[model samples]
Target: MALGGNPIFNGKNFRGATQAPPVPQAYGQNQYGQNSYGQGGYGQTPVMDAPGWAAQQNMTQDQLQQMYNRPAAGPAETGRMTYDDVIVRTAACLGAVMAGAAVTLFVSMPLASMLMIVGALGGFVLALVNTFKKQPSPALILAYAGLEGLFLGGLTRILDGMFPGVGLQAVIGTLSVFAVTLLLFRSGKVRATPKAMRFFMIAMIGYAVFALVNMVMVWTGAVQSPFGLSTSIQIFGIPLGVFIGILAIGLAAFSLIMDFTSIEAGVRAGAPERFSWTAAFGLTVTLVWLYVEIIRLLSILRGEE
Candidate 1:
């Protein structure tokens, strides 16, 4: 007896609680010249050989059709992240940043400064939010872009006010570095290997610590200059800040490489389509960092002169 009833009640098996029909086989041809077999005339037609369990089941046309039409069930689909997606998202972020900048330039400078501060704080918070979210949200990512835009705009205006044309120079510098890094990455000349990644992590930690210390010094009036000790110290008659800025820029560029690598891995691992937001967020972060570093370096150079 099967769990539910007798297994052989209807000439079927009651191996357990459920009963299963006997396997079918190709029967003799009918008047239509089609082979007929079991209750549904299933398995009457020869099918390609199936695996052991499937072969023993002798499936019906309806069953097979149902299986074919069913939604695929498995881990999320992933593939190599395409250049097109990255390019499109990056362009969108840049557009937002430019728009934010334009507002700061045309509007009150004080308001722009406030916005920049707000953006800096807001963007930092949201960056962490999006990074840890199990699933990426497009809205959050775009919001982050907007916030960072405000920050960049304010920063640019401040720097440009101090050093005429510095904004344009920084923009050009950022674009040049991005283009060069992208070309190198595409050409496989530079890669984010494990060793490089380890170094990046260590350098990033050190940089973050230094930035915090510098900011504290500025707030406490320990360093009277606009950029704290960065503007005061000199090496080879050049401001130490300039050298540090260059190194910082290099780190930002390498961070872009890591973002690219992660995107590639996500795509190849069949990550969900929505995860594209993560890629966009990462790129935005790197670009913002790059732009800030370039602008600061320009400011430091101008201050020296």
Candidate 2:
């Protein structure tokens, strides 16, 4: 149901129409790897530049000429994705979420719930703010993470109380999905292609509409069950909420794939380091959606039992 909120890229980093540059070749190289042709005893290579310079110097006359005539290094090669950068930023995001969750769970459930409502509201506002801002702000992104933590913590508590152990199950499930998706992405088993993206958009729209209608029914008391029509309907002897929950979880997983694709593209294109926050935010959003879906599904199953 587009559960985590609109993607932050929409207005902040990428407008309706903006594309990053092609992937760079020198993205993962050492900072000083570039070849510098300075006169130093003609054949005497400095220790720092020895390897690269020797390789160039050893080239055939025709090859040397071609190499010297090549264009300057592109942005991709000059400044690209680094494993360290992604790791540090991701850790920071997770830390914020955990810290926020801790406060919600240990201190006071009501306060935590209030914080979650605030976080949800604040996150929505910041998502729009960061999306539209010309430049990304680390502070805002981190703040979004914190707010989301509150929401997730409060949500986990509420669901956990009704369906004991669901919180831990959801946590494990979310991590497993993330790990598997990442492995597949790195191995090239899955990708975000034009066709898939198109389908995702259409499906997301339908899901959003359905959720909105369900919420209205729930709030208006048109359906007495906790989950409205979802809890009331059954298919193949299982609650419809369970079925919808599965679909929602699948959507969240696919959303992770999309997030990974975007991050890969950005890194290849030499996107500014600040974009790491955007990537973090996207992952957080997807994980939250995954957890929520799992919790709700568990609750539905428990209710049925």
Q: What is the alpha-carbon lDDT for the whole of candidate 1?
A: 0.70
lDDT of each: 0.70, 0.71
Clashes, model 1:
6
Deviation of model 1 at 293, angstroms: 0.3
Runs in model 1 deviating more than 4 A are 1-81
Best by lDDT: 2
| Model 2 ranges off by over 4 Å | 1-7, 10-80
Clashes of each: 6, 5
What's the C-alpha lDDT at position 299 in model 1? Answer: 89
Per residue, candidate 2 scores C-alpha lDDT tens digits across 1-305 of: 12232365544433221243333333222333433443345577655565466665666888756645656655434444445566677788879988888878786767877888897888778766766677667898788778878888888888888888888988888888889988987998987776776777788888888889889999999989889878888888878888788888878888888877776666655665556667777777677678778878878887887
lDDT (10s digit) by residue, model 1, range 61-125 = 78655544544322321222355665677687767777776777777988999999998999889
Best candidate per TM-score, number?
Answer: 2
Clashing pairs in 1: 3-16, 3-17, 7-14, 77-270, 78-270, 79-267
